[model samples]
Target: MKMLVNVILPIEPFNSMVRDGSVGEIIGRVIDDIKPESIYFSEQDGSRGAVMVVEVPDASAIPSIAEPWFLNFEAHCEFRIAMTPDDLKRANLSKLAEKWNGVHA
Candidate 1:
C-alpha cells in the first residue's frame, strides 16, 4: 500500500545541521533509502517539514521508513494510508452504504 509520511524536524538540530552543511547529505541518504514516489518540502507549524508519499509493504515497514528521520533529525513522523482513484473505486462504497443503511444504529 501507499503511505503518506509527514516529517516535522525540530529547529535546533535541523539548524545545526544546516549550518554545518550536513543537511543535504543526510537528506540525500534518507531519500535514497525511502525512495518516495513523491516528496515536498515546506514549513509546518513554523517548523521545517516534509511530506513524502512512499510505498509501504506492511505495518512492519513503518519503522524502517520513519526511523531515519527520527535518528538523524530528531524528527516527528506521522503515517497515513493513501489510495489512488482506482484504489478507491475498488472499495465498493455503494455496497457498504446499502448494507449499513439497513442497520438502525
Candidate 2:
C-alpha cells in the first residue's frame, strides 16, 4: 500500500540540530532509508514539517519509517493511506454506491 507520512517537529531539537549543522545529515539519513516516492518540506503550525509518500509493504514497516523522526527529532508523526489517480480510477465506486445508496450517514 501507499502511505502518506506527515511529520511535525518541535523547535528546540530541530533548531538545535540546525545550529549544530546536523539537521541535513540526520534528515538525509532517514530519507535515504525510507526512499519515499515524493517528499515535501514546509512549516506546519509554526513547526518544521514534512510530507512523504512511500510504498509500505505492511503495518510493520511503519515503525522503521517513523522511528527515525521520533528518536532523532522527537517529531509528531501521522500515517494515512494514499491513492494515486490511477488507483482512484480503478476503484469500484459504482458498486460501492450501489451498496450504500440508501444508507444513512
Candidate 3:
C-alpha cells in the first residue's frame, strides 16, 4: 500500500546537526533507507517538516520506516494510507453509499 509519511523535526538537535553539517548526511541515510516514491521538504507549524509518499509492504514495516527519524532526529512521524484514483474506483464507493445512505445509527 501507498502511505503518506509526515515528518516533523524538532529544532534543538536539528539546529545542532545543521551547524555541524551532519544534517544532510543523516537525512540522506534515512532517505536512502526509506526510498520514498516522492518526497517534499517544507516548513510546518514553524518547524522543519518533510512529506513523503512511500510504498509500505505491511503494517509491520511501519516501525522500520518511522524509527530512523525517531532515533536520529527525535522527529515525529505520521503515516496515512493513500490511494490512487484507480484504487478509489475499485472501492465501489457509490454502491457503498447507496447501501448506507438511508440507514444511520
Candidate 4:
C-alpha cells in the first residue's frame, strides 16, 4: 500500500534550508536514497511556514525514517495517508515546476 504523509514546518528556517541548498540536497538525497515514491514541500504566501508530503510504504517507517529530518525544523505531525489522484497530481505538478526551467534544448 502507498501513503501520503504531510508535515508542516516553520518558514524562515526552512527558507534558510533552501538558501543553503540543504533543503534541495537533503530532500533529494532522502528521497533518492530511501525511495519514498513521492515527497514534496511548499510554502504559503504571507505565512512563515511550509509543509512537506512524503509517501512511504506504511506508517511503520515514520519514526526512524523521519526523525532526523524532523529534528532540523519546527514541525507538526500532520498526517499519514493514502493519497488521492488530486493529491498526486498536485504533488507531481509542483515538484516538476520546481525542477523545470522554461528553456528547452
Backbone clashes in each candidate structure, one number apiece? 0, 0, 0, 0
User: Which of the predicted structures, 1 or 2, would earn the higher lDDT when compared with the native?
Assistant: 1
Residue ranges of candidate 3 with Cα displaced over 4 Å = none
**Model 1: per-residue Cα lDDT over 8-31, one tens digit each:** 999979999999999999999999
What TM-score against the true fold does each predicted structure earn?
A: 0.95, 0.92, 0.97, 0.51
Which residue pairs in candidate 2 have backbone atoms (N, alpha carbon, C) closer than 3 angstroms, thus clashing?
A: none
RMSD of each: 1.0, 1.3, 0.7, 14.2
Q: Which regions of candidate 1 deviate over 4 angstroms? A: 102-104
List the lowest-lDDT window of 10 residues for candidate 1.
96-105
As for model 3, its CA RMSD to the true structure in angstroms is: 0.7
TM-score of 4: 0.51
Runs in model 4 with CA error above 4 Å?
Answer: 44-59, 83-105
What TM-score does candidate 1 reach? 0.95
Model 4 C-alpha lDDT per residue in residues 1-105, reported as the tens digit of each score? 454555566675778998887886766665565565555556544444334445555568677556645776655545556668876786878668778858587
RMSD of 4: 14.2
Highest lDDT, which number? 3
Preferred candidate (lDDT higher): 1 or 4 = 1
Question: RMSD to the native, candidate 1?
Answer: 1.0
lDDT for every model?
0.95, 0.95, 0.96, 0.61
Clashing pairs in 1: none
